[model samples]
Target: MTAEVPTTPPGDAAATREASERGGLPGAVDPPAGGGEAHAASDSALARVVREESGRIVAALTASLGNLDLAEESVAEAVEEALREWRVRGIPPRPGAWLTQAARHNALDRMRRDRRYREKLALLAGATVPTAGEVDERLPLIFGCCHPALSPDAQLALTLRAVCGLTTAQIARATLASATAVGQRIVRAKRKIGAAGIPIRIPEGDDRADRLDLVLTVVSVMYSEAHLVAGRDAAADRDLADDALWLSGVVAAALPREAEAHGLHALLLFHRAREGARAVDGELVLLGDQDRGRWDAALLSEAHRTLESAARLRRSGRWQLHAAIAACHADASSSAATDWLQVLTLYDMLLRYDRSPVVRLNRAVALAAVEGPVEALAEVDSLESALAGYHLWHAVRAHLLRLLGRDAEATAADLRALDLTDNQAERRLIVARLAR
Candidate 1:
């Protein structure tokens, strides 16, 4: 189950806030106070803290415990302890370090209680607790949890749990699955890793390349979720985007020769540059309506530089092509100025590498931009069977039909999209479109 914010009113936000404050699970934090400015700032700060420290904590714990499931359980327990103790004692000067130490103690205690765990305890007994500066040493554990032997779903679950420090429920909300479903997936994945005796160490050379795709996939998923709340939600969410970027940088730094890593980093940077222009006065702003002048010129320049590096590597990957397409849009000052034809070409190239419904839905948008709504409608139509439950597919079709003057059909499609989506903000936007 992906973690998600509950859909209740602000009054219930307090309960959520307490749950998060206690840290028994990932994403149990309280809702931000104040509806407008104060809430946004608080949320942003919280998100930043999570993104920065979660991976380090998870990495350190996993290394110490030598079992993903045990490590996670211990970490969650430590966080819960912190919530209770910190409330009266006050937060430690280094919260991450405190949590890490607490979790390590918890793990050690658990091992001491179980005779079967004695062997693992012996290995960990002499190991020094990790400091903030030593967090990078756990990179191997990050790769191990995201290994390719695991299914994509398993990889995502393990990464969120072991790498991103998210609770199963949070992951459930993020993936639009049930908490039970997500929990089971995490359990099964952990069991598989343990039973398979998958070594918790990074591979070298060709073996590393085999796992690269899985690693990239995890980073991309994190970035996508981060982008969803990039600017619209509290500042805390913005930290999620930053966290994803930081982790991608870690991957890139470790594998500088990997073209796709550079490409993914560039793509995220380009998309992030538009965060400031994505919303106005608490309302969502479509890309077409956003003010180009508000875009981050510095970030845009950095994206271009990364794109150049990816190209110079002489390897063509999905991320490289997608970043190239984003660059096309970024180069344009306005929607009308965009190179739709070039964007369409890039989408076609992306289609060859990725068959994701989301990718197909995006390609349909580019098709509409360059070839008119009718052609785009054709593309959307072809995806109908495959994307029956996807909100964006219907939303795009609704827009295309509206442009084609099919009001009734457009309204039906819009309603369908609205029914399929659970995100309150996204739902409101679709409802408004249908009302129009």
Candidate 2:
């Protein structure tokens, strides 16, 4: 099952409603008008252009305007205008340049009406549109979004919106928050940035290391959300993962000495290598059951080289540790040949940095592979209260129970997992297990 790289994952019912309420997120920006296959092709091209170019354009604008809200609003307006204008004018030879100029003009127009930004208007009037090479301006914008002053939730929301170009609804889905809550956080965050006079400039020296950690965390979350999609629009969902990879690569390039950035890129690439085998014929394939032959050899090789580079740096961050765990699987010729002991060790290291219940749950899975179901079951039982509503916990417990010959309890656990999950593929897998 070859995966289609998506620009945005298809939203749930709530995201759909929010899109309807707000005319649509910038991601859902109207496509070129008209009908027929030709028009459809044009619409897809426009969306691709907008998704690929908008972040850099917005980042460059924010770097100059020193305002996240203004830059995003201006770029969004310009993209919307492009949907209408580009359809008639045909896409410019240099779409990024054209959009930057248009977005700058829009910012200038708005700034002129408000004397509060008279100084900004003067700066923008002379600001040159960033060339292709200058689009890495996202690094500064990322720092601004991940500012320590904001709450972690606010920081994550702002990064996804301002730097990653995810919509409020997309963020809401990813963070498991309501669209209203996510939207409010983004609004409040932008307001705080303005009030606090936060500037979007990349940190230097020691400051760079501290802030890059925050940036990497946000990118990791974005990548995790993008990595697994069962039944959603494959093309749209794939793009979110692609963007995460792109952003992580940019960070690694910008900070060659940062082990965490390289580790993250390696970690994501390792997982992405297996994406092709995650689903088969539109059905979810369990990791152990996936066809290893389908995995991307090129990505696995890159991940190996990247992980080695990060390890050479001698600073083993959480991402690097996680990448090591992924390596245990990637290096295996088959599931039966997997080095479960090595995987278990890496999880131990990961727990030292991140003691979240989710990590513990994952560690329990590795424990089952090494020590037997009884020991792992004990660990899963301890997390019962914490992961009660988390479908995977129940699913893991069910697997353990089945292995232990506790058929009745296994059935009940599977039922609980089925009840808790929204993923159709997961539900189907559980139901099939029950049927068996």
Candidate 3:
């Protein structure tokens, strides 16, 4: 794992596919080769490990180096070296361990050469990797990045960067923003944290709610982007989704008394339970058309139990309400058997918590089922100005428009949706409509 030493490369192992989903956030580069594509399987595996283990790595390094800036820079440098070195020598058997070792070495080398971190060399020399059972700093790091002093966009960039291990480019795509914008936000946020001495650990008592709300919101977006964003790397998406769920569980466990924590966990579980049936052979399946038999019974049961726990708290939050809406669908024997009235009612109640256009757009879907496509289409039309940039808005409009026999208008809407998204699966659904 030492970059400076000459050692035999590990034998070639099967490398997973690189992320292919493209169509940058507002304006984006081609999806990052994640791990660069230079070495194929070796590079891909390196990228995956880095993304999956970054939070753990950063936490340990930052704790040891006692400088967040040094930890991040060393990791980034190690990655760059790995991209070159890994290509020559096959990826190591234990990618995370190897990466960690390399990053530690990288940190040591930086301290020796870089004047700024020189004094911290003693700390780095004695630092050991945190054991598995030791306190995991990821949640604290997430809570810290999401401090109220930073703007929402800044909070997102930092969490995804520090806690989720996403490169700025990946985060940019997720937020539908330019990379420059995301990078700048991250830098400014970091400086603010340093200058203001904003604590990264979770706050105690009454002050906790504000940041925790932001944490849950960020986690939700992370999970949603895994499914909603178009990508060819199903494995990458799965990894990201798995991490999001893990993050949710960690938060819920840390704050057992918090209703929204349980609610968020339950909501994610409900979604995860249905993930298996969400698509077939990479083609998107509408909720009404998904194979119900493919849903994970165990996850569904767990979700229900978690939701019950949240309900027992007698605290009504948006997370619980969203979980309730998901439960309505999860409980149905078939799509047609779903109680549209109840679903609509939940959305109506949800409006009090979140009146965003996206929520209204979802409400319109229920309206389509209960009041017919005409009413739903009207509701969707009202959100055009607010949601024009979002692919799902155009997609739902196309669905409602098509249902009402407005084929020509539907086609236009469908095309618009297609343009706004690069996700292959979503595009396929839209293309199929055009082909029909």
Candidate 4:
């Protein structure tokens, strides 16, 4: 999620401000707040704090309140309160604890104010504030959001918004949906959870297997989005990818028998091991062009071991196929030495599991390497209707066209690819290719 938290809605502004003045932060503050400059600084600091600590704060609130919607609303109120109160009184020494406490207070207030939550009032009243150890409630929240009862769309939207703390727009962009659609999906999902009384706790046994698929999907989506970062705030992108990586590792540890979990961990590790070579001199580097020497050998080895372990569980999935493909690249001495036939075989298996246009496009590239441009061009052309708006599709078509000595068509395809993307690094690479 971006560091910038949207301002509180108008209805909650007064309540949040009131909550702030009533000792929201850790330190006691005298009334009569500071000037506008101090307010601005506090707002900036609050944004940073929220971005860094939002997951833990929201997790704790959800665990205590047992309502995803209430937890989110209360956390928003607490953050709004922090923006105002921290301006007058400097940020608390224990910011996470302060946010948790403030959120807890808001949750209690919500319970008392709303008749529907009267029953939960007793629960809220007895809820003890978590210390340093109990703050990480994200895993529980993840399981709750991805419950089997909810549709896949609901699972994805809720997990991204609630567990990952991503904004609607970020979720929309990552999932290729309109922001309004994503927001509506989240709202509906939360409503269903509340109406159905879905407990906000980790599932056990067979229930865990059902939910594990959804959890792996969420993590995989996050990891894939990292590749599209295109040098736009590389540090933030890396942090997000690392978060996905960490989450996958946690899943693998949690479910030792789930082969897909280990497979996902392996897949993410392979991708992460090559992150350094994805860009050079501020230009996006294609996988074939990336410097293999820059890849992390330790990570590569771990990926191999993890994939092997997953294979032994007698399970096969898209993640396992992807990891195998990555291993093929990692084991190659250079691009020229890459096992295109083996890579093509992996893509074929992946296509059976996932026939999305993007997968087809990638498989076409492998086909070009293994068969010939003529056959690959046929496959690419068939996907035009499905992937016309995807920049990478056009870019791949352009590469195939160039290989076939169709310079004019290749140039047109390259221009179309450039028009589809606003990412600066991507633009540079496409422009350089056009120049050639």
Candidate 5:
């Protein structure tokens, strides 16, 4: 959903400037090499549940035990155990419940030795297994992690680790920081959260107001990461798009009065509506070429209604503007029917909230649609210094150059994009472009 038209960028150590400019999301891990390693990580239900449910399991444990580190550590232990046990025994009927129970037991075992966590163990006793009545605390965990007491980088790192289950190395690569720095950020963040006695629950009143955008940003980053990984079908270890949609919906429901929350939901839905049509038989389908009929009409209708609801609140934010832009594309009868002018205007407004080159690069796409490739080329070229390492930047540049009949330059740009991209689908598309 991200980076195809303008598409999402994959961040790494080389992405120093753009990493800060874009949200911190690592490139997808390449598929495992062979045999048991592949089966454990990919070819099993154990892998699916761990990918989808680990964050919520960790969040629920953190809420029950009131210890972030222990909850996360215990969940990790439970997953390791699952990797070993689930293969021999097969997946349990209720994987989340099973995981929650296993993680709780792991926590109790660890806490029994700690002695200091006796109170926590005592508190954990009543809810040993997950029940239907047990509330999902992932939304709360997300808000609590984004608390303003932590620095912005620390906040991003902590949320990605706790809520998204990203490794410190992955977060560091995306943020262009050392693994040590990311480790320090997470350590200090946990300490600050514990010292300040931050509750494992959603903030209320003005506190929610201050952190809502940050929370949505974190959620969007999660979806972006999911979208990127989903594109790499060979390495598709997790189908996090459903989880991301559910989390965004939960956050939006939890804070109904917040326009941006609904806006974020609408933005995601607009993308989801067309997701099924994104690829066909292992080849990436460009937006223009994809069958419009394949887009989910129900989801598109709901996204419009949601966007309209957001408008009625009269509280405009960047997310709302983004939804409006997405709406423009969704409403078009065909790619040629897309309202590039209104889309460009929305990007204009988006600049007020974020002037990052990623946004500018996306805006250049609309610029090409409305003003022709020459103007868009200049715009894309301006962002070269900041986004040279990002594959989509060159991909977009190649598109514009090819449009302007600069074949040699376009070939060179496509080759550069091929070098930078790790996603198999995008790489194939670039290879196709070069062949043309």
Candidate 6:
């Protein structure tokens, strides 16, 4: 029997709702039939199906179009064609090969239409057509789209659009931004790439290492965002988390010597294990409150194995320490049994490596666990100036203050956090905590 193909449409409320139900992993949610549901399925399939055959699709399109911009456009057009054609004919047996051919044809037609495209067309026409196995060559495209030259936000947006096949609206929703804003960012990034004549080839040596850091950062951000809302969204739409892991794993596989790459992969794996127990009955469950048994044991074991390997390398990077800290929590049978002192030590090491306001905020949480709320409150106060607009800073402060019997201050801080955060779920959690 043939394996069933999973698909979902972009921006369909029901599709998004279903995707959310599946933990936000794209292509995991089945598209509803007709009434625009099929289209939603197609959209979801377009964004995520590429993952299954990413190497073949990317290699073929890149080889055909020469230019990354044109190649991306052709690929998107091909996916659209599939949506229209597949509804009646049904999905082909060799979908990736079909997409590759369709995209190639689309690019050839575009080149034929452009008067100034002769040189590029000739270059593409002379190039050997890529086979499915050659899709690994497109890994360079991933690095190029997520180049360090671009802003972190732009790198992520471009990577999702070019590498992951996400629509601007989907990208915006994933990042909690307006679609128009994401669209503008993508346009600007593409324009910059064009104007700068940025080569699509992957970097080498030191330059490659630098670019890899940026790529890993983008992936880390996506994983963190997905983890934050794991309970709120369906499992299938949880692609952000999986995409992050996939990209990080790719980087780790490609650059085995890079300790940071391994560190990042371990960090994501560790966090993902806790995703299952993050919420109960649609309400957010604090780490302290979550049942340990609810956590995915296989994922947790994988995370520990990765963390152990990362530790054996003996490179004390931020991600490594973070993963170690997460592993400590994973080892505990209950929240009260957590080794807060060890967690605090890891946080100290992490702070030494990177002293961002965000890291400091997390350290404060650990401090609260180990040194008491009063000490944690002091640590938080130190971060107030730097993290003035950050909601979590205020939220942490409120929690600490409330524990210290300062109800008035706790209420005020909670209100400030509510005003600052845009996430409805997070805001709701903060409000409920304040009410308590």
Candidate 6 C-alpha lDDT tens digits along 1-436: 0000000001221122234345443334344565355555545564455544443455445544546667766765676676667655666777767777787788888989997777777776666545544434556777877766677778777776666555565566455457788778787887787667666667899878767766666566555545333233323336656766777787778877777788888877876777677755555566777788888888888887776776777776877877787788888998789898998998898877778776777778878888888888888899777767656677778888888989999899889978865545566677777666
Rate residue 24 of model 1 by lDDT: 27
TM-score of model 3 vs. true structure: 0.86
lDDT of 1 by residue, 1-436 (tens): 0011111101011112224434422343454354334433434333333446556755665676667777766766765665555544555677767766787788889889989889888677666656655535556776788776787777777776677655565566456566788778877888988778666777899888777766776676666665333113322255556777877777777788999889988988887887787655555567777798888999999999988988999989788888898899799988888898998899798878886666777877888877788887887899888767656667778888988999999889888877866555666677667666
Alpha-carbon lDDT, every model: 0.68, 0.75, 0.73, 0.74, 0.75, 0.66
Better of 1 and 2 by lDDT: 2
How do the residues 1-436 of candidate 5 rate in per-residue lDDT, one tens digit apiece?
1235432333211121122123221222333465455444322565456556667777777888777888877876776676556555666788777877888899899989998888876678876444534445678889889898999888888987888766665566455467899889998999998888888888889998988888887777666665444225422223666777878888888788899999999998998888878766766787877798999999999999988988999999989998999899888998889898999999999999888788899999998888998999999999999888777888899889889888999899889988876678778777866776
Question: Candidate 3: minimum summed lDDT over ten consecutive residues — where?
Answer: 1-10
Q: Put down candidate 3 lDDT per residue, 1-436, tens digits, no spaces.
A: 0000000000000011113233111111233465345456665676677666657777777766655666777776666666666676778777788777888998898788878778878887887765334545677778878888999999987877776766565677666577799889988987887678676577898779878887887788777656654445222278878878988988898899899999999999998898888767766677788789999999999999999999999989888888898899999999889998998999899899888676787788888889998898899899989778767778888888888788898899889988977667767777877999
lDDT of 6 at 34: 59
Candidate 2 off by > 4 Å: 1-39, 86-98, 131-135, 230-236, 419-421
- Give residue 182's lDDT in candidate 2 (0 to 100): 88
lDDT accuracy of residue 331 in candidate 5: 85
| Candidate 3: Cα lDDT at 32 | 45
Local lDDT at 197 for model 1:
68
With candidate 5 superimposed using the best TM-score fit, by how many Å does residue 417's alpha carbon deviate from the native? 1.1
Which residue pairs show backbone clashes in model 5?
2-7, 2-8, 3-7, 3-8, 4-7
The RMSD (Cα, Å) of candidate 1 is 6.0
Quick one: how many clashes does candidate 3 have? 4
| Model 5, C-alpha of 213: deviation from truth (Å) | 0.9
TM per candidate comes to 0.85, 0.86, 0.86, 0.85, 0.86, 0.77
For model 6, state the Cα shift of residue 218 in Å.
Answer: 1.6
lDDT of 3 at 225: 54
